[model samples]
Target: MDPSGLPDFHGLPDSPVPSGAHDSPSLSALDRRIAGCRACPRLVDWREEVARTKRAAFADWTYWGRPVPGFGPPDARLLIIGLAPAAHGGNRTGRMFTGDRSGDVLYEALYDVGLASQPTSTHSGDGLELHGVRITSPVHCAPPANKPTPAERDTCRPWLIQELRLLRPTVRAALVLGAFGWQAALPAFAEAGWTVPRPRPAFAHGTRVTLPATDGGDDLHLFGCFHVSQRNTFTGKLTPAMLREVLRTAAEAAGAPTRK
Candidate 1:
């Protein structure tokens, strides 16, 4: 771990870092570091440019324009993984899946299944909370055209790796939003001492993969769900009921109690 808060995790091992380790920062501290990262020049330029060029619909709003961190309680039992932040969505609101149509769909389903406190996530301090699940993306910074380059994705890997290490203690199940998220999570889990499948598990709706845990942790239950993007939602590929079912199943697998 880098004390200076650079993306350099050169000497850190793959296993979970002890909770109160002196040299390394905690999850909250790491999140601050993630927001301040300029390691990828391309990403920094793009996100800032988007912020500067205000969207017509959001001309009165101030954009956060930085890397968004995972949202939810630190002791969550489930993790929700997404691909990357949308330009005007997370880039504007500074919270993953917030102020976007995708978030509207996702949070609504999460609420329906008793995972999210509210049915919408409009801003950072909108009083919205996730019950037993935390949400994160493989790429923290919003990318151009909603697509992050291969180099950018690899450069951002260490952040996700570090986050997984911190969350490993309480995270017993994971709900991956799409193929990209599934692929991104596999390496992070493997690096965190979870035994991923040899050939890699194929991505499909409702797919489940149980990973045997190392480091004295419990086995991780993996669930696959289609992303809550408008492309899928409008086309009827991923419906509200479909997403709710998957989320509820993940919560059940993790033994998470429902508030609803």
Candidate 2:
């Protein structure tokens, strides 16, 4: 164990076989790559600065200070898409929806709807598990002002596309957390050659849309909802029940079995 008593995987002895000899590419590996990425130098520098100076209120906390990566079961069919990482939230936790007020209500609703194993999201090592759901974002790296430009969003779409293609989920339903996520994903599908419907509607608390698959076969269903950010939850704009109902409807539309 390391000084913190956490398992020291980084200090393991070399194995007989090569590192990639018997391993298969997985979401965990993808996450690691994203964590080390410096694709956007501005974001890289800004995130690191926040990590170094703005420590959490809790003394024991250590900022993740890396690009937050997608997290959940590998074969999860439902996808929860958010706008971008928050400076003090995912940017500090190295995992989506951790270490922020936004996560408190989100995880609580997920736990209530059987998507997560725990309700409180304090840190990455909190033993939380997701069932049949994966949380991702339009932009993996946190922007300086929490708003990525259209070009930046475009630049990041390929990564998300790669993730979706690798997972090959049978029923893909996006829980778009805000207008930005919806805007980013729509053009992505179109560029993939999917003929999307016109007049993309504004995001609301619970709105759903269906689109033709960009692959020229199958269909992709998309759901829109207000982001469970501190702004929304703290202002009573999005209640836990409202979020839960949106998730339930999305799950049903995707044809996934309801949690017991």
Candidate 3:
């Protein structure tokens, strides 16, 4: 294991395994390892810095200050991939996409599709549950200015790669939230033994791709949706109705049986 306590995948070629990928059967155990990661010095420094110097609105709140982990059931069939945690969002709330405008938009959409137990994700233990979806990111920690260098992203690839390996059996499809997330996920899918398309699919507002199974398992479907960031939402680039339709499609594709 390296300084991040992760088995270094840096030595591998043609593989984008998350540095933290390992043989842990329980996602909870994997999450614990993710929380302890300090693989990227720049991100490690930046996330902790924001935690200590919190915004005025959350001045009294204690921040998680560690790598945020994927949230939802272990046997989830639908996976939602997004960019890294927000400095004051998941970095503060210890849950993916929690305590932020992004969650406000995402959870609301998930609820519309009957995938979320609640319409709001305020904190880690808020009693919110995702019916058949699991949420994760390519970068586990909050990056500086919300931008992770290519090297940082590669180093963190193993965590998500391993997550895919564990969930492949049940995960029928994945919803990639943005171009960054789309890029991050496709490579990891290839690394996790899925047969990616010859010419990689281009990303768009509603792009869809099908990845065949190499291990004789079920094929995996991929969908694209504009990120639910404030920049997009506040500007009307991605509205509630738009997001709801995408989530409804993704959930149903994953066999969630969501009602229209």
Q: Is candidate 2 or candidate 3 better by TM-score?
A: 3
lDDT on C-alpha atoms for all candidate structures: 0.82, 0.72, 0.84
TM-score of 1: 0.89
Clashing pairs in 1: none
lDDT by residue (tens digit), candidate 3, 1-260: 11112222232222223345256676776776777787787888899999899888888777878888899899999999999999989998888998899989999888888899889988776778889899999999999888999898888888888889889878999999999999888889998878899788989988888899888889898999999999999999999999989888888888975757
Candidate achieving higher lDDT, 2 or 3: 3
Candidate whose TM-score is highest: 3
Write candidate 1's Cα lDDT for 31-63 as tens digits.
666776676778888999998897888877778
Evaluate residue 260 in candidate 2 and report its C-alpha lDDT on the 0 to 100 scale: 44
RMSD of 2: 5.4
- TM per model? 0.89, 0.84, 0.91
Error of 2 at 9 (Å): 8.5
Error of 1 at 193 (Å): 1.5
Give the residue spans of candidate 2 off by over 4 A: 1-25, 56-59, 191-194, 214-217
Candidate 1, poorest ten consecutive residues by summed lDDT:
1-10
